[model samples]
Each structure stands twice: as structure tokens, then as C-alpha cells.
Target: MDPNAQPDRLSDLPDVLLVLIMSFLSFKERAQTNFLSKRWESLYLETRDLSFKESDFLTASVYANPIRWLKARADFVGYVRRLVDRIRDQPIETFGISISYPKPYLELIESLMAFAVQKRVKSLVLDFSNLVWRTYNDVNIEKLVVKIPQSVYDLTSLESLEVCACKDFDPSKLSKLGKLRSVSFGWMELTDLPPLLETSRLESLTMKECLVHDLEKISSVHLREVAIYNCDFYFMCIFNLPRVDIFKYRGDIMSFGFDQMNTIISEVELDFGAAEKKNDVSYDSYGIEAGMICEFLNNLLDEGRRTATTLTVCPFLLKVIPRSEHPHFLRPMKTKHLVLKTKLHPKEFNGIRLLLLTCPYLETLTIDLLPPSPIATASSYAGIDPQTYWMQNMSYWCLWEALTTVIVKNFVGGATELNIVKCMLRSVGERLERVELHMPFDLDESRKTFALAKSEMLQRSSMNVKVVVHNS
Candidate 1:
């Protein structure tokens, strides 16, 4: 047989690996691939991941009456239900659904989750943010969050779930997923999150824009890493997680049992810029959590005997408090990897250098422009003209370049930003070896500057270097 010959009867790939590959595909793509042969048609149904995206709907668009759109949505959903209902054996791992234009309102989802329950889905992500915003004139944004059908909670095998841009997802629904290891909830009307406190195995959690009444509920013994945005961590004593390492969040951490943590955590990551964008109208340019994380870091260093391996911080709207507020304050850090990322407002840049001075053993240092994100869109469109379009872009570079390794992402290659980045690579880092500049676009001048920076760095740096240029 020729090496490039097509195989017979789907003998080309192993079933488990086939399922794994299948897991990464969209539901429509999976369905289309199934049509390639009989073996594949039934293979996807047996695979662990299943997704239904309303964007994949094949029905004709309706321009005038809402009833026509509803009917088409119903028909499209019925097609999905019929196909899933016939699967010989249920897939037992991942199940997902995204409704881009939900009309005839989720009666289809009621049936879909029932199928998911039968499939025993282990990881589930459901997005209902699309409420026919396109084509229909009767779209009501508020209806999207009113109350997700209660059947969503029936997925008992779910281990990781991300529900975005849709609502009425009472956290109580999570209690049914006994084995959940990670849970992320966003844009829901979550006033309190006591419901999530019970998930002991949760390793990574991201909460956004919810009213968190009790922060103490999140002190899970097994939570190893956490990222929160726009949500309130009401303040609770954080204890030692022998295993927990990375932590990131924004908004308010109102209270703390800082005195209780009994062990050294290997890493701390704090990010708050997007939140400043999200709560623009109510933007406390200096968030309460900004100081809280700094204090948390200093407190942990005070108690920890072991040096941190990685420390990442973003002080977006908030800066160091006045010395009078904490007269005896000392920066807490002794890490090999130190990252300071932000769009620096002059006021916010005050105490950053002092904090870096404490990380004497630091080996890897990165000073990044504020990262890009899909979530930040809400703020720019929030109807409030941003008080300062260039609010935090100006930064002091001389202080940042002193660290060993420098990596910059989202470098727009603006003269000022590039100068700041290049100055870091050439100046302070005598041992700088790996310099990565990932640009989103290809400009010949940028590449030339990169090479020039590399040459300049080689003359001064005391280490062998590999300069990587990643252009996207």
C-alpha cells in the first residue's frame, strides 16, 4: 500500500485519540466530519465533548415578525435533539452549547441538558448571551438573564464549567457537580457566592462582576490558583495552601485574616486594569483590592521562610498608599521571576521601584504594556468618554529593565512603548539571555529595531542570548 493512501474503515486513528481530537472541534465541524464515513458518524456521539452553537444554525433568516425567527430556532434545535437522542452510547466527558440567537427561548436547551445528563458530561460550558440580537427587531437584552432553566444543574459529572454572558445561574446549581475542579462565572447577577464555597477540589476560579457577600466562603483548602474580576471578595482569613500558588483578581477584598496563612505560596499574580475599565462609571481609579494584594504580598513575605519563585502584579488604577498610612510598610518579595505589567499612570508608579528593591534574588523580570483582552470592551463602550484615553500608558522604564529576562507581549511598536521595551533589554540586565518580542503585525522597521536591540544587548549582557521574534 502506498504511504499516502487513504485508509479503509477509519483505521487511520485510534478511538481514544480520535475522541480527544473530536473534543477540540465545534459541533457542526464534528457533525460534518462524521459524514465522511459510517465509522465517524457514530464516533462523535461516543466522544466525550459535545457542543451545540446557535451560530451553526442552518435555517433561513427572518426579517420582520419575531414568530418566524422563533419557528426557525425551534426547527434547528429539534434537528439537534433528534440527532443526539439517537446516540447509541453517551459521551462521558465534555459538553458545551452556545446560543447566538436564542428565540423560542431555550426549550431546546431543556432537552439538551437532559441529553447531557444521559451522556454524563464531565466538563460543561453553556453560553446563552445571544438573544437574537441580529435580524429580529424585538430583541430584549434583559430577557437573556431572567432565569436559565433549572435543568442546567442536572449535570452531575461536570468538573469544570464556564458560563458567560447569560444568567439566572444560581450558584446552587454548582452543588450538583460534586467533582468540579474549576469554575468560572461571568456577567451573571450573582449577589452572593456562598454557594461556591463548598467546592473543595476547585483549583482555578475566575469570578467577574458579581456581588460577593462573603469572601470567607472562598478559602477552599484545595484552591491552588484563582483569578477574580469586578467581583467582591468580602474579606476572609486566607490560610496556607501547601499546594496553592498563583492568585489574581480585581475589585474589592474588603477584609482579610492576613494573620492566618501558615505556609509559603510559590507565586502571586494580581491584575486589575480591566476592572477599572468595567466599572468605569463607578471606577474607583484606586480600587480597594489594589492595596489589599500589596498588603497580602507583604504579609505573606513576612511569614514565609521560603523565597517566592514567581511574582506578578498589575496595579492599574491604584498606587502605593501614602507612607503615613502604613509608616512601617516594606515590600514583600524574594522571587526568581518578577513581572510588573500595567498602563502606568504617574500617580500609580510611585511605589513600584521600592517593591522591586525587595526582590533581590529575582532572576526573570517582565514589564509589559497592559495586556489585551475581550473583557475590556465593556468599558470603552460604556457610554462614558474615558476621562483619559491615554490614562496609564506613560511609564518609567529605567526602573523596570534591571531584571534578568524580559518578555513583552502586545507591543504595538509605538515609538515610546518600543523605546521603553528596548531600553530594558539593553540596559540593566547583565545576565539577560532570552528576549522575546511578540508583535501582532509585521513591520520591517520593528524587526530591524529588534535586531538592533539584540546586538546592543549582546555587547552589554554577560550571558549567551537567543532573541526570538514571534509575529502574529
Candidate 2:
């Protein structure tokens, strides 16, 4: 080669650097790079991260055709087996497989999992959505649910594990994988989770749409974050989670207890969306345990505890907080960021008022305004006006010295919504710096009302307060 000739920078790169670049691409893309040059031919084999998705091998039309779908599934399974065979002796840093076919590919899946365990794969994700299939005549072509092989438990090097659409998952099986740190399960059925806490070094846990029965206690010393989204559980107790800093729960929580969560929790989000009506008949018979829920929140948000600095609450939860338990609601919280997901109903504004009164150090407020539900608009309490009620207790409305930012989303600028915005602007006073209103695109006569509200809010805001209104 001539000295003046331009050098092939990519080809001349170090082998380790090449392999690192290949790891970011999908397995198919990485294999395609083999034809680039003789040096690149064997380079893909050294790639440590392997990701396989059935959709990558089949087109949408192929998936709709039963014959083509079956053929694609067979080809995908064969490819996976051959790939695993090649990398069986090598170490894999990460491995992920997502199969949406409703077929019993258990043998093929298990083979890959066993190989990964043998190779000491650190991160593993298995997503099998819609795994059961039936023909138009109701004849079952495949009726399968994932049962994780026992070999996976022996992968002590495993750091992260995510399983979706698995059935009858047991945490006890993970006892041997002491190095497991982060774990997530979706659409699964679990009897208990205490075993995972007692055995593994789990730091983060997430459960989505999972049915948990007899989940009595979750006592984890190493857990840092737990997110339970749209999960159904019989009863649960948080006996000991000393290190948890971020906690989020959505859906119906019939009964729960927080016994030893005294450490500083940075963020707490709770959304009990029509929990009372959605709960089981036996659970609904008792109705919302307002006292228990409020007591737990009071302890979690107490000034002395100083745990939660950020809080997010949905309007439905206000229905669960009985008026009889007003003292529990009065406990001062140290929260600086408050997010309210509510339809600006007059009754719901009372809850917001209570929060404003308690969170004295609130700095940032975010409101997700939604349309009032039929149940709310038709309720007897709908006529109760928050402004008139607050006027009577004017002494409770004090200046929020620390509040600076306000973000209102889905702003239709209805009467109740405008009142809420005005209340926040007046309450925050000179310290408030910015207010962002995200208005809906499909505005009716409320568009003019929104402009008026915006003007009024600016007048009530601080001298330097910047108000921004944009179509959402």
C-alpha cells in the first residue's frame, strides 16, 4: 500500500473495540457485518451480547398466514439453537429473547436458557406474550405457559432477570442465584416474594399486571426501588425495607402495612383508581380502609420521618381518605415536588387543599387535569365549592415560600380547573418562578376562558413568574 493512501480506520480498530461496537447491534445485523471483510467474518462470533426476537425473522403478512407463521417459527428456533451451539462455550454478558408466537416452544426456549446458564450470562430477558393460541373452531393448537427451568437458578453470575407472561412463577427457585440484583416480572402469578428478599441481593424489583396471592410480607434490607403497577394482591405487609428510596404502587391495594420503612424515601407515588369497586367481593365488603391507609401515609410522610420528598397522588385516593381521619391528613410532609393526577372536580380540590396546607416546603407542583367521571359529576358532593369552603377557613391558606414551578397538563380551563390554577398561583406568591399550562388541542368555548385564566394567573404570580401556555 502507498504511504499516501488513506488508511481504513474502522478495519484497523482494535479487536475489543470492534466487538464492543458489534454488541450494540442486533444479532442479525451483527452477522450481516461478516461479509464486510475477511477480518470481520469471524469478528461477530466474539460479540458478547445476543438479542433475538421472533418478529425480526417474520414479516407482518407472514405472521397472519398460519403456514408461513409455522415455517418462520421453526426457522427462528433452528437459528437460535445453532447460535447458542456456537456460543455455548463462550461467556455471554447479556442475552434476550422475545417470542410473541402462541406456540409451545418450551424445548427450544429451555435449551437456550440452559446454554446461557452454562455460559454464565449476566443479564437475561425472556418475553413471551400471547403464548397460548386457538383456532377459529376453538381447537387448541397450543396451550403453553412458561415454567423457568431449574438450571437458571444455578446461574450465580446472573445480575439482572426480566420475565414477561410467565405463569406460576416462584421466587424460591431464585435462592441459588445469590448475585441477582435487579428482577422484573409481568403478567405472572406469584404466591409469595419473601423468599427473594431473604435469599438474593436484589436491589430493584418491578411487578406489572401480576397476580400475587398470600404476599404477606416483603422484608428486604438490600432493595432500593420497588414498582408495583396494576398488580392484584390479596394482602401485603412491608415489614422491613430499610434501603428503599423510590416506591410506586398503582391499582387496588385492599390492605397493606409498612412496619419498618423508616429510612429516607426520596419518592412515593400512589394511585388507587376506583380500588373499592374493583376489589374482590370479600375485600370490597369491608370497603376502603381509610384509617389504615391514612395512618400509613402519615407515618411515611411525617416531618420527623422526613422520608418522602416527592409525592404523586391520584384523585380516586381522596375518596378513600375518610373525613373522620382529618388529623392523619394534617400531618406536615417534607415533600418538595407534588404531582396530582385528577379531574378538577370541586370535591377533589379539597384534597389538593389539604396537601397544599401540609406540604409547606413544596417547590414544584404538577397537575394532570382530566375530565370528571360520570360518577363524580353526579355525586352529591359535586355541588360543594372549594373556594367558598376555603373562604371560611382563610387562616389555613398561607403563603408557600418555597414553591417555584407549576406544570398543569391537559388544561381544558374549565371553571373548576381555572379555580385550582388561581388558587396555586395566589398561594405560591412572589417565590413562584414559572407556570406551564399544556392545553388540549380540541378546545371548545373554554379557549377564551383559558386565555382569561392565563392572564389572571400571571397577575397573581410573582413579578418574575414566566407563564407558558401551549397546545398539547
Candidate 3:
């Protein structure tokens, strides 16, 4: 009976609802839907989101044949022009364009952006990573640097803007786009960022692999999250941010200062990876990198104690701190969550102990174990047994009564790992409610280690500490 019945129920839907459904389809699918019926064709034309990507034009054949690639690129440009023309008058809500950077395509891209602005698009994303090419000689081809057009800056309705692999990104060019809330710039060059922070109503800002110079301070009242990753800057300071709750930094900070901070931050992640050389307090100049790191840690901990409930410290950052200053620098804090990213070796065991002793009120502890570096393992024991080391440090061990949960990820259950677990079990006492050990799935020995760890914990028989072990 259904064979003869036409599927007109979908076709009978209202034009507005049909267009809404079409919005979720890809550009190619939406174009194909035009052949379904005249009603579908009309609704497809009214789709709100316009995404034109380079993959839509060329196939894998273009990679091996240069001539075909050229022709496909040209065809893509022509198609993009036609689509932009059709959508120029329509009310667009979001616009995204990803294309290889060619000199001839710049004007067309700008025209599309101008059209989107005129149509009051709310979100704009321009990605040009495809233009990057590597030669056989291992040299990178020069990238096309497109200065964002003024139309983008003037889009009053724009709420989000993300531009990748651009140059000369001056935030001062931005007009008062009152609705702008989120901005991300990647692989760009920046001179000053104050104007952008002071002018925009942004809630989040992220800069990745950008070249920044003389960025003095960022003072934003509306910002809730800030992430700076692999960026180069001479000097930078977060002067004032009353609402920021999450902050992450992953690059070299020549000189960092937090002049003002919110009283209650949810998380703070610090990754001092390979950025020590660029840091303003250089080891070569001061000849006391450890002291400098200790000073920096003190400042960070002081500020974090007032607000941050969770603190994450990378392994590289820990390597910079002097072993002697560990206890002093890691004084007692109100932080409830502490995460240590390190190789669980005998040498690092002391640092872990110092952390537990310092953060007396820590409710949750997470240890992310990385593979033991050759240097760390070779020098970790240094003829000192881990058990003996822990025995010597037992006098400094403070009762971690508030600690209710412990998570050890990437657990391999080596003697060092077992020793650390035993020490924690002893220190946490009967109040410990749960201990979770996440072992690597690829290692066959993990199951055996889990069994041993479970037995050892059960032998304590002090309290019903739930020992949960699972494959990571």
C-alpha cells in the first residue's frame, strides 16, 4: 500500500520549518536537495548558514596532477562567487570559508566577507591553513598574509570571529561590535591587544602560536576564560579581570604579572614547557633558575590560594623548582583540588609528598603519570630506596584528613608507584573514602599490578576504602 503513496508528509511541512531542517545539511547536500521539488528548492535558497570549503571543489586526483588542481581551484572560486552573490541579500546567521591562499582568491574572499557583514552574519570563521606547503628541500613556502578587512571589524551583529594563519592582526582596527563575545586568533602577529580587551564585550579569548610584542596588560571585566598557547611576547600582564574563572597558559611568558584577579576561580592550568629560555627571569642571567621558579611558584600559589579551587602544574614546571625549596614554596593552601603531571619515580615521590603536606585541605588529588624519561629513571633512584626515602620523610608528613579521593592515572604499579600508594594510604588514614587507579590498557601486566594493589589496600583493614582499578 505504501509503494504507491508519495512521501508528501515531509514536503507538506511549512517553508520555515523545512528551511530549518535544511540548515543542518552540508552545502553539497543542500544544493542536491534543490532537485527534490520547487518548494524544497526555494527553502534551500533561504538556508541561513553558508559554508564554502576547498574540499567541495577538488578530489584526491588534484594532488597528483597540478593542471587538474589549477582548474579545480578556478572552478571553486567561480562557484564561491556565485554562492556569495545568491546569499548577498539573504539574512545569514553564520558564515565559514576555508580555502588555500592564492593571490587571485583574496579579493573574492573579501567580497564574501563583506556580503556576510552586510547580511548581518553573527559568526565568521576564516581558515587558510591549506595554503601552507613544504618543499622537497624541507623549506616552508611563504604563506599568504591577509589583513582582515574593515567589514569584519564593523559587523555589529557578529558575536564570534575566528581567524587562522593571518598576519598584521591589529585589534585597534576593530569597531565597537557590541555583541562580540568570543574571539580566537591563531598563527597571527599582534602588536597591542589592549584595545581589543578594553573595547569588546568578550567572554572568552584564545591566542595560539601567535607572535606578540610588548603586550602590556589585559584588563577585561566581562572575560570568563583566557587561553594563551605557544605565543611569543616580550612582556605581558593580566591587570584586571573580575569575572575570569578559567585561565590557561602554555607558552613562554617573558614577564608575567597578575595585578588583579577574581576572588573565586574554578581552574588554573600552567604549562611551562620549553619556555624557560624566553622567560624574563632567565637562568643564564640570574644563575639561580630554581630560586626564580620558586619565586614564581610562590606568587602563583599566593594568588591561587585566594581563588582557585583546582590547580594543575605541568612536569616541566616542577623540574625548575629546587628540591630544597619544595616544602617552603608549597606551603599550606585552601585549594581543594591538586593535579601533578609527572613521572611517578623515586625522585618525584618527594615532590608528591611535599605537595600533600603543603595542601592540608586538599580534598581531591590527581597524579597523571607520564612515561619515565631515560634521564629521570636513570637518576631517579640514585642508590636510594624509595621505601627508605619515604621513611626518612615520614616526620614531615602531615595528616591529610580532608583528602577523600585519590586518582592515579597511567599507573604501572612499579615499586616506586606501590611505595607512593602505601605512603598515601598511611597518611590519608581511615578517612580516605576512595582511591582510583587508571592503568594503561596496552600493558598486560597492569591487571596483575591492579590485583596486588587491591590486596595491599585490603590488608590495611582500617576503613572501607573503595579501591577501584580500571584500564585507561
Candidate 2 residue runs with Cα over 4 Å from true position? 1-47, 53-91, 100-102, 131-144, 234-236, 274-292, 302-306, 319-330, 370-381, 384-396, 410-419, 437-463, 468-472
Query: Positional deviation of 66 in candidate 1, in angstroms?
Result: 9.7
- Candidate achieving higher lDDT, 2 or 3: 2
TM-score of candidate 3 against the unseen true structure: 0.72
lDDT of each: 0.58, 0.71, 0.69
Error of 3 at 358 (Å): 2.3
For each candidate in turn, the TM-score is 0.68, 0.72, 0.72
Candidate No. with top lDDT: 2
Which residue window of length 10 is worst by lDDT in model 1? 373-382
Which residue pairs does candidate 1 place in steric collision? 343-392
RMSD value for candidate 3: 6.6
Stretches of candidate 3 exceeding 4 Å from the true structure: 1-92, 99-104, 129-143, 236-238, 276-287, 301-305, 324-328, 345-347, 371-398, 411-419, 439-463, 469-472
Deviation (Å) of 354 in candidate 3: 2.7
Which digits, one per residue and each the tens of the lDDT, describe model 3 over residues 195-245? 888877899999877767777787899999998887767665645777889
> Which scores greater on lDDT, model 1 or model 2?
2
Give candidate 1's TM-score. Answer: 0.68
